[model samples]
Target: MTEADFAFLREYLRKRSGLSLGPEKRYLVESRLTPICRRFGIATLADLVGTLRLSREGPLERAVVEAMTTNETFFFRDRVPFDLFREVLLPKAIAARAPQRRLRIWSAAASTGQEPYSLAMMIHEAGAQLAGWQVEIVGTDLSTEVLEKARLGLYSHFEVQRGLPVQLLVKYFTQIGEQWRLNPAITGMVSFKPLNLLQPFEHLGQFDIVYCRNVLIYFDAPTKTDVLDRIAKVLTPDGAVLLGAAETVIGLTDSLVPDPQHRGLYRQTAVGRPAMTHRLAAGF
Candidate 1:
């Protein structure tokens, strides 16, 4: 692809999806979009860009954005985030919502349902302690394709093998031949939606915990700040937001501040509530 075509794609993705593609990432663009060109019978990336320019908001445009957005995720992909949820965030949310007995968690970058499903599994493991509480998990992504896969709650053997404990796998999943499907009880606990973090999301309602892991790294500094600030508006007064292992709120926005006790967990300072004093809970 010529520099002009590449620049067009970079700006297009950044505007629509908040992705910042530098000049060095030309290969990434070419490799990921080449298949789309073939599928559409377009000759090259430049032709693809020309078509995209002519047909904004068409199925091809949507497919291009989805293909470029990284959706790499697995069950409990990183141990620490889930541990933070079970040990610190969950107990904190449980205590905070005891009066209303309703708790909501948002997997903001819920790629294919693993994170939310894992949380539902943990809540199920809570058993008696959470018996009477009303808990909900909503998983949202920019890609409708992945969201559909998530709705099905189906996983290949390789998918189940990644960071998923065998015990929980056996207990929560049924083998469908060589693949595993999450049980209805766990699958039904969560709802999926199509969301663009670059857009308004307050309509989704306030959440006690928002897991925005590994999603913001693709954005530029300004986009990161804007997304985090908007996220603050949808957080419950004492709600927590979790970032990816490599992501942080420091120097990004003042709306959120890091939890003193955890690495990736953050709470909204925009609400004027005092920082939560976290107590580590039992193992999951």
Candidate 2:
């Protein structure tokens, strides 16, 4: 790809999805978009860029943006976050919301449904603790293609093997030919939607927990702060926000602060101050 081609594609991706692609990612851009070029019968990367420049809201634009967005995910990824959920976050949320008996969790950038489904499984494991509770898990992603797969709740043998324990697999999944289908009870607990984190999230309502993990690394600092700011508005007063292991709110935004004991957990700073003393006493 030429300099002009690279620059146009990079800027287009940044504007469309907040994906900050530097000059060094030229090879990545070329590799990802080559398939799109063939699909559209374009002669070269330059041609693809020319076509994209003409129409920002065209189907080609959506294809290019989806091609550039990384959707790497699997069940129970990076175990610690889920561990924190089961042991600390979930119990605390349950206790705090016991009076209302309602709980909501949002998995931002929920690719192919594994992350949210994993949360659903955890809710199932909680059993009687959430027996009378009204629970909802919302999984949102920018890619409509992946969102459709997530809604289907079907995984190949390899997908189920990654980060999924054998006992839990047998308990929650049944084999259909070469693929495993998650039980209806687990699938019914979660809902999938198409969302762009760069856009507003007020319509999604408030949640007790928000998992926006492993996605901010692709964004510039300003975009990161903007997305975090929007998240703060929809979180319940005592809600917890979890980011990727490598992501943090420090220096990015003042809306949230890291949990003292948990590695990836964070709480909205303004509302969290009064709860800090109580959280410490509860060993959270």
Best by TM-score: 2
Model 2 misplaced regions, further than 4 Å: 271-284
The Cα error of candidate 2 at residue 230, in Å, is 0.8
lDDT of 1 by residue, 1-284 (tens): 89888989999999999999889999999999999988878897878888888856878899899989998999887889889888988887778778888898999999898999999999999988787898989999999999999999999999999989999999999999999989999999999999999998867877788999998999999999999988887777788899988899899899899999888889889443322221112110
lDDT by residue for model 2 (222-282), tens:
9999998878767777889999989999999988988999888988877334544444355
| Full-model lDDT for every candidate | 0.88, 0.90
Highest-lDDT candidate? 2
How far is 221's C-alpha from truth in model 1 (Å)? 0.5
Colliding residue pairs in candidate 2: none
Which TM-score value belongs to model 1?
0.94
Each candidate: how many clashes?
Answer: 0, 0
